[model samples]
Target: MKIKLLVVGNTTDSLLKSLILNYKKRIKRYVNFEITELNIFKFRKIILTFSNQIIRLFIVEQLYRDFTIINNHPCHNQ
Candidate 1:
């Protein structure tokens, strides 16, 4: 089975990236895992102000959709 981890932005910290890669290597011993870092867009300040909690909620909700789709796909189990 293959598991794909999709991320919106690249991790800037070299140490952190190395740590993640090391963990991925260990995990790959038992499963097929891939990490795809996507550079979609740069963050820009929004004119409309929203509370931090509200912004977090919206982001989580949106991410949930992507995860659900990935999880439900037949490839997820293979």
Candidate 2:
């Protein structure tokens, strides 16, 4: 069974990033998932503003420790 992990968000917080990494590590055993930015248009920001929360919830509700979204980047060791 292939599950897609979509870590869609538009924030740049360190805690959020760490969570994403943790999600990735936990979901690599089931499907190919990665982190991706929610591409909301300039004018459509209003629509996507509250929608991101729904997306996040959906990810949490349906995702397991074996799914990936497929946009992950390497963390810097600086």
Best by TM-score: 1
Residue 18 CA error for candidate 1 (Å)? Answer: 0.9
Score residue 51 of candidate 1 by CA lDDT.
Answer: 42
Task: List TM-score per model, in order.
Answer: 0.52, 0.45
Please, what are the lDDT tens digits per residue for candidate 2 over residues 1-78? 444544444645555556656666566655565656656555554433544644554464346421333334333222
TM-score of 2: 0.45
lDDT of 1 at 67: 52
Relative to the true structure, how large is the alpha-carbon lDDT of every model?
0.52, 0.50
C-alpha positional error of residue 8 in candidate 1 after TM-score superposition, expressed in Å? 0.7
Q: Which candidate achieves the best lDDT against the true structure?
A: 1
